[model samples]
Target chain A: MSSPLLEIKGLKKYFLRQQAFWQKWTGKKEYIYAVDGVSFSVNKGETVGLVGESGCGKSTLGRTILRLYEPTAGEIYFDGEKINDLRGDELLQLRRRMQIIFQDPFASLNPRQTVEKIIGLPLKIQGMKGRELSERIDELLEQVGLARVHRKRFPHQFSGGQRQRVGIARALAVNPSFVVADEPVSALDVSIQAQIINLLQELQEKMGLTYLFIAHDLSVVSYVSDRIVVMYLGQVMEMGPAEEIFSSPQHPYTKALLSSIPRIGKKNPSTGRIILEGSVPSPLNPPAGCKFNTRCFIKNKPAACFHEPPPLIEGAPGHYAACHLLG
Target chain B: MAELLKIKDLQVHFFTDYGVVKAVDGIDLTLQEGEALGILGESGCGKSMTALAVMGLVPFPGRITGGEIIFAGRDLCRLTEKEMRRIRGKEIAMIFQDPLTTLNPVLKVGEQITEAIRLHHEEGDLSPASGRRGFFRFWEDRRRREMAAWKKAVEMMEKVGIPSPELRMEEYPHQFSGGMRQRAMIAIALSCNPRLLIADELTTALDVTIQAQILDLMRRIKEDFRTSILFISHDLGAISELCDRAAVMYAGKIVETGSVQEITGAPFHPYTQGILASIPRLGEKEYRIKPIPGNVPDLGDLPAGCSFFPRCPYGQAKCKTELPPLEEAGEGRQVRCFYWRQIRAQREEEGGIGGELSFAGD
Candidate 1:
């Protein structure tokens, strides 16, 4: 589809654990496999939903893609150009096209800074100043549906929804082409979350922006995303069109995640929830084979699950799943 | 089937510098014995404050100035500080959203649980074992009672599905996982065999699988202990799952109260309906979001009439001047709305929200 806007191939970001004295003496080592071998492509003018449990590396992946955290391995091609090798001024120039919106609007925002300075800081950093920067700040604030009067007020003075709107304004300040919204609506209340989601959707349409929407919540991701990626521990479980993934999920983990969502009223007959027995395994020492095999609802799994890691292969036309059982 | 806790016209105000923040303004609530009542609301709705008022633990600068909290046969509001302390965690217990913070990091998990048990010991509990209860058996009874409480703490841990209760009991709150910590907290709350358990978003911090586990555990706790739960949460799904009846709160007032079915199914208050519509369901694709128009009004300086009128889609000129009273909408349903009857009639005619929102994508 027009040679995708962002293509990540076998991306891996691992952090070594601070070893104990004895471990260091004996040369024992371990790695927190936060984002391991993740691959996906986001086309221009599209939103790809990344769904996983808290420690499933969705945030890490999002951060690593934007070079907020450098990847230990693999390639990143943004706008059909190799970006993993970019340095200093070159990287800064590339970063002008990428931005991230954090989860906690309260924590992400500088408490002491006024909304105007917060929005203007990004523009000022990008060499824009004087009347143009102030005007651009006003436009950004208006674009995110915030009042002009709010620009002078501090972040703490605004409500959660308003603060989130401010966060959006800051993200759009530099006019980034690619945005990573990491659980943007998670910290907000339902009604507030809806407003933020609608704002993001509208902004995406108007600006022709591409978003890598990262969230633990499937419902939220589904609401605004065109494509959905399901991950467990640190590996992709299933990736497909939003409709296909929700309507007819292939991977067991995806099914479990979908069912675990507490919908109002009766449990749907379409997919009975399979509540996994154990909690997510530690990322530092993930399971040997398939990351999800330990908690996979599929019973009597073959030994291959514990031995061989499944490759992400297309199950349907555009749906990809990493499961040995799928052929 | 008698009412365990009855709160009538309860007004809790935070005496802030800005103004008297009416956190819980004139809330009328009733919870039956063994019934789980879910208080659903956004952050500033004062649901947590109501629970705190029930426990007589409203934080500093906030006081319950008016209203009656009738628990058992007596008015709880009339209780002295010393008397209220006896009922705080004994007859009524609460678990906060964050178990990590709610739990004492310095103390062992079991110690805290045992402390709750020993402090709120039933007078008759130790008497049976120590026969001939005269001047003598005081020291003997104390030792025996202490031993019983220790065992009870472990028993509670086991009951809430904490594995290796004996070992986990010795560990501090930080030692346990997120799910285990919540279970431990639940155990401590249930240790006193509290008749009314007030859980304020206990499962919010947990993951979905663990949330399911915790919710299932709470359901079991209610079934086994017949503990009347005043469950407060922002998650409607969790509310729908655990609550028999739910009250939707908005800016220090309950907009609607009904059975779980009515709250989720045929909600009269536009806020309740809007709340249900806002959360995207898992089963459906293209989650048609119909966000309420504006933010909840500044509680410090609320509007002339309805607090929700500023955001409500169905708000009219009449709503702007007159605050709607909480009136009986139908059987076992109370709604604070001026146009509920007409809305219900319109729903019957137009199938949903009078064509405003048509259960889009359902």
Candidate 2:
């Protein structure tokens, strides 16, 4: 296989809590392990879907890879270059090659900015000007299935789906090879979701764009992704091709998640569903070893699952799972 | 089986500045005792509006223009506000989508639950308020009843699968997580053991895993209490799993109604077929999701004929000229489409509606 367009290795991001007067004096601090030790790679023109429940650090991982949140440790290599060590103008230049699409199109776009300005801001920031920027903005809008006449309209004038198209147009303005789409279609209606997914797929084929699609909807991920990575409580649980992961999920957590998806047919009487008991454990104090050990339903769950973190082992060719069962 | 609730020709409309919106034009549904009826539709299809109309909880600018909501052999529409209030929590209850919005923020969870119980008891004639005029007498009786109801509320909370109900009861709404808050809402809704429960998109805001758990809990509760349910949701997969009978609503009309097996296995209506086709299933190598084309019609400016005519793939001249009444299409199946029979025959010839019937693998 060719080298991945974007590669993340042992990426970790922790936020330190603001210290109160007493805590400051005592030198005590707490940290939120939002994205800890998450590693994945997206090859050129491949869509890698990151699936997890809310608060499982999927969004944080997406943001960290795009450098929206600076990584606290580890490294990110884009096009075979270590991007974490870059600084100032060099880092800004590198950002032009990668882009991000936020979850809420309403909140992400500036209400005061017109559609032209919103889509042209990236080109303007990259030092394009005058006729070149205007022409590029129009092209981007057409590419995302929006009309150039909408360029003068403000964000409030557009519908939810239209606003998302504007966001996608802005993301493509810079001609980035890799994009981090965090729940891009979750906020849209079902019919609109299919439109956006089709648009993204079409755009990928047209531009050879690689996408790191992050969402909680398993069905959406299964449809869009070439490979899928399942995360739980800030750690990777399973990684494999989308077909393999959905058809024969080896990890217990993946199996539970797949079963949880409601399917339209006669109810299966014998396939026992694994209803994950208890809420996701707090990220600040995640359990040692397998973060999913508390919810694992396997009989004879190994004692090592609580004390020793299992490494990602190859369960099959091109499939990996981090569980003591695999070990 | 005795019918617990029967709604006929329900018409709910909102008087907006733009125009009079026919949100629920004409809907008919029935719920038998201990039966779970699922209302399946996309957003703006009037599924939730039907639920609110049944519960008499339509918001401002909206009203149940015409309908009969007969619950427990009583015409609820004819009842006075005072009489309806008495029956709301004692004989029928509703669980909303967002639990926090339904719950009081300032009050402790215990107080909120006990308040429901106290109101139910007062309505049931089980508690007679003292006529004494002093402030102390009122205060004393209120405290005594609250204290007694708190214990019963804790028991109800425990029965709904809440852990350490006694301890959690004293906590505020913010202390409970999303799933836990929903459980508490369910506990409060079922505290009086109402004969019918109306869940309006209760699991929409929850995660898939939590949604499955909630659906299972509702199923278990129905079997144990022998209560009927009006479960409304947009997820066909979820409704198929939890509901024995399913109704597909569109533009305030139930376009299709049938047993879950028939609805999911061999959907008759164009809208139902479109929805089933759009859903992504497990082990399906073909990932192309054929989404239903076009948007739902704006209620204020509905088309001259069928509301779905603009989007239906098989729409014809007849569909654009006259509205189709929901008619019996087959055994245990009803459809509201001008060309449903023709479409079904064509679908069978073309290999059964995008291979969904084959997916079931009979």
Candidate 3:
């Protein structure tokens, strides 16, 4: 297999939480453990889908991979070069090769700027000007299936789907080999979402690009990803090929999550659904041992699940799950 | 089942500066008592507007130009604001997509639920305006009723499966999580035991797991209360799970209406078919996502012919020139397409019927 284009090792991100008056007086420091210890890799021209619920640190992990959020600890290697020690111009060059697409098309795009300027800013930053930059902007618009007439339109004039197309155009203007699409289609309507997904796939094949697609929707992620990484709280609960994980998810958390997805015509829900009892615990005070133990629906769960943290153990070839019950 | 809520040719139009945007342009829907009816549509399709129109809560500048919202044997549109207010929450309650914003942030969760109870169920001689009494005696009577309403609120919280109801009741809306806030919203809506409950994308903002919990709660509530639900959503999965019958809306029109099984299993309308095909299926062998080309039609300036003509794959010359009436397709099924029969036949000839519409029909 070719070397992975981007690899993350034992990544961790902790944000300092604002303390109460008593805690402040006591000089107690508190940290919100966002992306605790997530590790994954994306091969060249392949998509690695990072799936998790909200507050599960999936977005934080994506930002940390792109170095948008400085990691508290761990290493991120792009093209086999460690990116942690890079600074100044080196970091700027790293950013040029790695781009990110945000979830909200409305908030991501500047309301005042025209589509031309929005897509042209990145190319202009790369020193392309005048006709060269304008041509690139038009080309990028057409590539993302937008009309050239929309070039002069503001963000407010366009629809949600159209604004997302503009966002995609801007992301590709840098010609980045790797893109972190953080819930790119989540904000779009269902039909519009499919269009964007197809657009992302087409762009990937045409440009031979790699992706760290971060989304909460498992069905959408499974369709686009070659490999899937499931995160809970701030840890990887399971990782496997898309098909294997979808068909036979090993971890209790993965099973419950997959089963929770309400399919269209699937009747006799009692036999299929494993409705988890409670919501995900606060990440700051995540449960001891298995992070999923609080909501795991497995009957007579092992005592070790509550006391001992399970390491990611390979079940099937390439399929790894972190759960005491798996043992 | 008895007819609980009926909307006939509802026309909710916004008289904006640009033009009259027909938000709900001549749509008809009926919800049977104890039945769950889902309205599946895209963002600008006016599904939510229909719910708001029924509740007499259509925002400013938007007026019900022409329509009759008959609820519990009374024309809601003809009723006065005071009369409508009595029916709004007591007989027909609606929960919105975002509970956090819909809920009053200043009040305690329990107090909000208690307000709903107190509004609909007032005790005799307890209200301050009931009669002239000593000030302290009137205050004492009011306190007694308020405490009774608070007790009912605790029961409502327990019914919605909220833990530590007494403690959580005193907490503010911001103190609750997204799922819990939604549960609190449901508690407030169900406090008065309404006959018809309208849920507008209730689970759209929730996580999948949390969505499952909310859906399950709704199902249980439907059974326990026998409350007819008019569920409006853009998600087919959630609609299929919660609704017994569904109506597919496009550009403020009901393009298709049928049972949930038929809508998901053997849809005839091209828009319904397109929506079904667009969603990525998990267990399917092949990825058969065929996105309907083109954006949703602009609500302000819709085509005279079929509203879905722009994006519909089976559109013909006649569809572009003249509108098609919502005609009966099968038993208890309606389709507003001129070429639905031909389109279904064409797909069947290609053997796409059995292979496609992969909603996990096993």
Candidate 4:
């Protein structure tokens, strides 16, 4: 088999919480496990979706892969090169090949910057100057369905959907092979969301781009991804092909997530509305073993779930779920 | 079934610096008692404006130009400011999207609920201060009666599933989480037992898990109180699951209105059909998500004929010149389209009931 474009192994990132007054006096520090351990790979020209709830570490995982946040542990490989260990100039070169499309269109771009400056900033940072940068900016703008005239207009002058297109254009300005789209359409309207999704698909095929699409919306993820990864409390609860994850979700958390999606036409038969009990556990004090053990609906959940961490085992070909029930 | 509220030919316009923006052009809607009606639309579609007009809370520079809002057989539009204030929270109450902003920051949760009840009761002339006000208002008997009503407010908090209602009642708004605050807001709105509850995206700001809990709670409370709800949201899936009937709004007009089944199973308007096809569903085979080309028309500078003609896929020559009237299409279905028959025939020819309406690529 050909090598994947991106490979992540045992990636982890922990954030240190603000020291409490007592802890400051005592000279103690506390850390919140944002991303405990995640591993995944994206094949060339393919999209892998990372799905999870708010504060579940999906975004952190994406940022760590892009090296926006330094991983506390684990390795990230891009195009057969160990990128996690790269630093200084070498890291800067790797950044040119990897870009991220942030979630909030309003906050991502500078309000004072014109569309030209916004899209051209990346090329400028790489030392492209004079007419060369302006020409490249125009081409990128047109590629994302924006007019050349819009280059003079400020970010606030455009609508939400338009602003996102400008963002996509900026991400592409670097001509990156891999892009991390972090909930790119979540802030957009439903009708407009389809526009952005279609644009991304078109861009992917045209640009031969691979993506790590992170979003909490399952429907959108399922529609866009070849493979899907479900995260719960900073750990991969399930990972498999999009079709398998949707058709036969093995993890209790995955099942609840799927069932929670309000179907358009069919009557919901399983009134077993699995409302996962309890707000997400504080990341600082995550439960041991399977993080989802506290809310698993299955009656036969093993005692090992609380004491021993369940390894991600294959429940079916190409389908892996971290659950003691499968064992 | 008796109609609880009827809004006819509602027109709301904002007198802006640029021009008089026709935010809500003309809308006609009816809500039956104990029934849930969902207003489905994108932002700037004027769905919220219709609700604001109903509540007599249109912001500054915006005024209801012409309309008849009949609630419980009375035309609310004609009521005086004083008369409407009397009916605002007593007969009708609104729950805004952000519970934090809707609640006063300084007041305790208990005081807010008590204030709602006290206002309604005082209006009904049932307060213990019946007559003697100047010097004897501080009497012990009157003070005891006031305290008793405040205690009842605590009881209302528990009815909305708030934990430790008595203790939590003393906490400020910031002390409660998003879901708990929404529940607190619901408790305050229900204290007067208003017949009609207008919830404007009450769960939109919440996460899906919390949203589900809130929806379930709203469903349970709806069953117990038999209160009619006008649930406004942009999420069609949530609306279809919760609302009995729905109205699809676009460019300040109702493009389609029908029972949830009819709206979801077979939408009649072109805009409605686009919205349904645009959303990607779970477990479905991957296909190119067909977005409606172009953008929603500017409310200030609307198109000549049909407001949706610019982005509509099936727009014809006549569509640009003549406005289509909203007419009953079938049982429990209304559509605003001159060529729905032609579009339906085309969809059939395509070997599907709901095919994407194609537009010429610009």
Find the candidate with the highest lDDT and give its number.
3
> Candidate 3, residues A145-251: lDDT per residue as tens digits?
99899999999999999899999999888899999999999998989999999999999999998998999988899889989999999999999999899889899
DockQ of each: 0.51, 0.55, 0.72, 0.46
Point to the candidate with the largest TM-score. Answer: 3
lDDT of 2 by residue, B1-362 (tens): 99889999989999999989999998888888989999998778899998888778889899989989889899888888999998898889999999989899999998889888888886324344555677688776776677778878999998888889999999999999888899999999998889999898888888878887888788788889887888998877778778889999988889999988789888889988888777665556584677777677878899988899999999999889899998997776789998988998899898856334644212
Error of 3 at B222 (Å): 1.0
Identify the runs in model 1 with alpha carbons over 4 angstroms from their true place.
Answer: A19-26, A267-271, B122-146, B353-362
**What TM-score fits each model?**
0.95, 0.94, 0.97, 0.93
Better of 2 and 3 by lDDT: 3
How displaced is residue A25 in candidate 3, in Å?
5.0
True contacts kept of each: 0.50, 0.50, 0.73, 0.58
Model 3 chain A worst lDDT run, 10 consecutive residues: A264-273
User: What do the candidate models score in CA lDDT, each in turn?
Assistant: 0.87, 0.86, 0.90, 0.87
Q: Is candidate 1 or candidate 2 better by lDDT?
A: 1
Residue A260 miss distance in model 2 (angstroms): 1.7
After TM-score superposition, the amount by which residue B155's alpha carbon in candidate 4 deviates from its true location, in angstroms, is 3.8
Interface RMSD (Å), every candidate: 3.3, 2.6, 1.5, 7.1
Question: Model 2: per-residue lDDT, tens digit, A1-327?
Answer: 878888889999998877788998898888988888988788999999999988899998888887888999989999999998788898888888899988899999999999999988888889999998888888898998888889999999887888999999989888999999999998877777878888899999999999999998898898899999999888899999998998888899998998877766755622577788878888878888889988787888878999998889998988999988877
Which tens-of-lDDT digit does each residue in A1-327 have in candidate 1?
A: 666999999999999899888997899899999999989999999999999888889999999999989899999999899999899889888878999999999999999899999988878888998999889988998899987899899999988989989999999888899999999999989999998998999999999999999988777877778899998888899999998998898998887777777767653312355777668899988989898877888878989999999988898988999999996
